[model samples]
Target chain A: MALDQSFVGRTYPPTDSYEVGREKIREFAEAIGDTNPAYTDAEAAKALGYSDVIAPPTFVFAITFKAAGQVIEDPQLGLDYSRVVHGDQKFAYTRPVRSGDRLSVTSTIEAIKSMAGNDIIDIRGEVHDEAGEHVVTAFTKLVARADREA
Target chain B: MTAKIAYDEVEVGTELPAQTFPVSRATLVRYAGASGDFNPIHWNEKFAKEVGLPDVIAHGMFTMAEAIRVVTDWTGDPGAVAEYGVRFTKPVVVPNDETGALIEVSAKVAAKLDDDDRTVRVDLTAMSAGQKVLGMSRAVVRLA
Candidate 1:
């Protein structure tokens, strides 16, 4: 089934704020084998002018991806979770995510298209800090493969 | 994070140091826990095979994160990256073994944008098992 084209440009409500914790940042950095001191050491981050420990650039993906769940779970979207694969991802940041900051995301359907029998959807997640300041925007492209036999 | 390189010193086509990132099943498990992405395909070999994958695979996000280390290490500041993007063209398959997989990343300055912030666009190539796993990988970094 094809996705509803009307969903394009539809924006979901902002999700509940998620607190960016220092420990979680450390764990994420370690998982990726990044030993950058700014990721784990507050003094290092402060020296760079950040108030506290800042997460690696990719850390926001975890939060923003979770926020995209609302779009994926929408019944009207008719997206087959089993057939979907991530196609592309991009992020633009106003600043690095710092530990102790609270963030939320508002997802909007950016585009919808069908090509070569595959359903391609683009969702943009706008992340904002507790102060209502823009933090980052993550663009996620999902491709649902068409059934070959069909 | 203090930037190690000055913008004026870097020119278009300057290559950052390359890096190799190793991924094992245990690494995938740890990443799954850390990222809160509990997808069975990234952890359970049986489930992954059942889903028609060759074996358990590393998360695309994980691979993306690993590839960006080359840029962050060069900049000396993870936050120096103002924008980053990638296309998951191939999966970085992680086998259930002591040595899972190795992702090799090499990046170079592709372009310098006209801006007062001293931003440069970096083009990255990530490979695993001698095959490209990521395509159109690029990052825009603000240099001091």
Candidate 2:
């Protein structure tokens, strides 16, 4: 089934703020096997001009993706979660995300198309700090494979 | 904290040191836990197989993170990256064996942007099991 084309340009309300934690940043860095000091040590981040330990560039993906759930789970969207696969991802940052920052995301459906019987959707997540300042914009593309028998 | 390569010292076509990352089942599990992406295709072999995958695979975001290390390591600052993007061209399949999978990442300065003299665009290639796993991968970083 094709998704609702009207959903394009629909923006969800900002999600509740998620506090970026130092330990979570450390855990993410360690999980990725990146031992960059600026990711784990406050002093190192300070030396680099950040107020505290900073997150790796992709750390915000978790939060923003979760926010995108609002769109994916929309009853009107008609998306089949089982057939979906991530297609592409991109991020543009105003600055590195540091620990102690409270952030929220507003997700909008950028585009929706059907190609080769596959449903492709583009979602854009705009992240902002507690001060309502733009932090980063994450673009995620998801593809739902068409059923073989269809 | 500061970039090791000054903005003035690098130009187009400057190649970054290549690095390889090893991915095991445990690594995928840990990444799933940390990133809050508990997709069955990334950890549960049975589920992955049932879902038409040959084996458990690394998360695309995990691969993206590993690929950007070349830029971060070169700049000596994790915050140096201003923009990053990648297309998931292939899956890095991690077999449930001891050897696991190895992802090799190599990058180069693709271009110097005109709007920002302090920033340059980097092109990256990531390969796993002799197959390219990411396409059109690139990053924009601020240098010292």
Go through the candidates in order and give each one's C-alpha lDDT: 0.93, 0.94
Residue B134 of model 1: what lDDT?
98
**Candidate 1: where is the Cα deviation over 4 Å?**
none
Q: Taking the tens digit of each residue's C-alpha lDDT, what string does model 1 give over B1-144?
A: 468888998999999999999999999999999999899999998999998999999999999999999999999988889999999999999998889999999999999985698899999999999899999999999998
Q: Judge candidate 1 at residue B19 and give its lDDT.
A: 94
B-chain TM-score, candidate 2: 0.96
Candidate 2 chain A lDDT trough over 10 residues, lowest sum: A73-82
lDDT of 1 by residue, A1-150 (tens): 677788999999999999999999999999998999999999999999899999988899999999999998888887888888999999999999999999999999999999988999999999999999999999999999997877
Model 1: pairs clashing at backbone N, Cα or C within 3 Å: none
Pull out the clashing pairs in model 2. Answer: none
| DockQ for all models | 0.83, 0.85
